[model samples]
Target: MSSIPVGKGIPVDHVVDNTAEHPGERAPLVLNMHEFNDVTTTVCRVAESRRVPMAWYVAFVFSLGLLGFLGFCIAYLFATGVGVWGLNNPVMWAFDITNFVFWVGIGHAGTLISAILFLFRQKWRTGINRFAEAMTIFAVICAGIFPGIHVGRVWVIYWVFPIPNQMEMWPQFRSPLLWDVFAVSTYFTVSLLFWYTGMVPDLATLRDRARGKIRQIGYGLFALGWRGSNRHWHRYERAYLLLAALSTPLVLSVHSVVSFDFAVSQLPGWHTTIFPPYFVAGAIFSGFAMVVTLAVPARELFGLKDLITLRHLDNMNKIILVTGSMVGYAYSIEFFIAWYSGAMYEKFAFLNRAFGQYWWAYFIMVSCNVITPQLFWFKRIRTSIWGMFILSLIVNIGMWFERFVIIVSSLANDFLPTSWDVFIPTWVDIGTMIGSFGLFMTLFLLFCRYLPMIAMAEVKAVMPEADPHHDDHASDAKDEEGGANS
Candidate 1:
């Protein structure tokens, strides 16, 4: 095939059929075979020799401001104590736990896309999985902050660990909070290793293409002397596959453990057997929305629209719709169980969640999570960059409210009418919540500046040229015909 120039004037029908091995597969970028090598190199240039673009600088500076605000709030929180926030008798676990669950839920989509989808051989994940995993790490970091501070008297927070002390006080092995400590920490550690391990080859590529000695050495340390030899590739591939296998179970269990925080509780709205599945679905739903929220902006700012394509956005929207539906089903089931079991407290708790003082929260949760995502069913809406970005943000807002409703609404009306007290957030509560975003964005910005945003090695692996029989299609067809004649 002759090399046809791909330009602004080039038509979609003009794309070269290099995907012969995987016929009928949709190309995320729609590059012709002639453009593949150059385009692939262009994709990695940001990590190689490219200078910092103006937009990245602006974003990084803005995120740094948020990071500074986060620091101030945390310092103030430590100095003032938990009393500074809006914690009362019933709402003791209100906004802090709500933010914890919200951020943790936001991290779930990364593992789902990276480990689970890879295990299922989904090639589409190759483009976005790297940064999604990075976002998960940042999110888990944000998630941990609220709980650590909420423990109040942050200096003695180490008491939760299994370490021995002079008083012979051991940590409770059965606590859901303890379970969250173990679960979130383990997920973060495994995810970090998984992400860095996947980046080694790409890091090596960057190292080889480094323009200066300092650049080469900086990338070299993480590249681990990767020579890209067959032996090196063999070991790297096995380790990655092992990590992927391990992470799949961790992804499910981590959120299940998070759900235990609610399910193990005897509180009327909290003690449901269906919580594990419900939380897991909601986590993935929210996580995908957050991913789209981050990815849409980053792609445009970095000229990465070709890599993170409209198709990718569309597919992610579909996930938001599906999981949002699951969450809706869980809501219906919870209401049904409340009425069917003749549990007045359970019935009253849910009714109060929708109709009491915090009715606005419940409405926001339902509208944002369940109703808003249904817009993605329209192809034009899902495929539009601005449309996807706005909807994704809406989903994020809805998911946050979902956690708020679960934590605050339930606690605001406990078993005894006398014990019931309306929960309200103070500035400290609001500031800490807002600051967590700053912390999250700070880490994510650093990631984009220093590391390969997309998984260059994996992306290339999924390309049409990576197939062994890519160029021998016609010859293979002839061989098959000859064999059949025999």
Candidate 2:
């Protein structure tokens, strides 16, 4: 194997020996890294550098423009009321709700990567977990915006809370809509805490290495005085494990509750026992795709290809395949259940989704969410950088259409044919949806620029050098000492 200098005087194979001779041996999770300090240097260099990449500036400016457009759309909605959206009489929920659910699903992969994989001891997660976690925070932020603005009375939004009011009215506790508030809010709070807590060590590294007083103080404040002492490491591990445990249930529950927004409703298409699990699967499906979508450009743009390797991309693609299959199965079963029930309303709901006015949307959803991911069955596609990246984008687009088909199609043409109407999204609706992507990218790019994009401490833990047995000097010394004693 070819060697690389991980640190001064520390030389090791950048890529582990996984040739035909070592069939049982595992490949390294972190390439181009063998020393613990090298991991720190590799990750921290991006945040500490003064020369900004032109790609970052270009992306930032474009995202900022979208964010500004989002602000304008929201402001216009406030002034003109919800009528500005393409929402019609029966289709009261359209792009706003679709975007809300889409963003919520986008957030799920982060917690799954950080918490679930951590619990299961999936070491490959070290490369992508921090990125995914940050994505979760930003995505949930985008998701939260819709619920606040979708309600026509934006000023009276506080009424959703249980605070005492002059009218002596409290929020309807039994409402599924109210449950969403608790579920999403709790998920965001826990996720934010988990993301920040994991960053504490890396933040401290940045704090210590920061060139200026302002940077040191900024990173130090959030680092919470994290010293690399035995006691500090102990507490950090304990806290991280606890937060991971706490976050595990949120991954399944948050989206399940989000599904409850539709499942609990009396509408034929909306009411179903399958939505909870189905939504959870689709959430993970879309979430992982979003992670890959970000990871591809991120790895390329930031010169992190060595840290975020093809193996990481391949593993994530495998997951996208699994969840995409689940989503496909859910789609098939929904149609089957509709047929088996012999309920005309349910039957029409499923048939209308495919043959109705919005059939094009349904086609796009199935094509993107189901057929696109199936291509990953080929090893060549999964390993190909451009192939997986394009597929991931397609999956995200399909997932968004999935939400659109579920909400708009069902609501647009309900049991009462007299009330049926075609829901056409106005420019405002399209722009707002586009603008949420702007908001997500804006937050994510800032995170990449200022913060440690990868977890320094965690990445080191997965390196070959972390194992005491892997040190040649220690082994050689032990052998020499044994010979002398003998």
**Which numbered prediction scores highest in TM-score against the true structure?**
2
Clashing residue pair totals per candidate (backbone < 3 A) = 0, 0
Stretches of model 1 off by over 4 angstroms after superposition: 1-40, 48-51, 474-486
TM-score against truth, every candidate: 0.92, 0.94
Tens digit per residue, CA lDDT, model 2, 49-128: 99878999999999999999999999999999999998889999999999999999999999999999989888889989
Clash pairs, candidate 2, are: none
In model 1, what lDDT does residue 402 have?
Answer: 90
- Which TM-score value belongs to model 2? 0.94
**Residue 420's lDDT in candidate 2:** 95
Best by lDDT: 2
Q: Candidate 1 lDDT, tens digit per residue, 151-219?
A: 877887898888888779988988998988999999999999999999988888788878899989999
Minimal lDDT window, size 10, model 2:
477-486
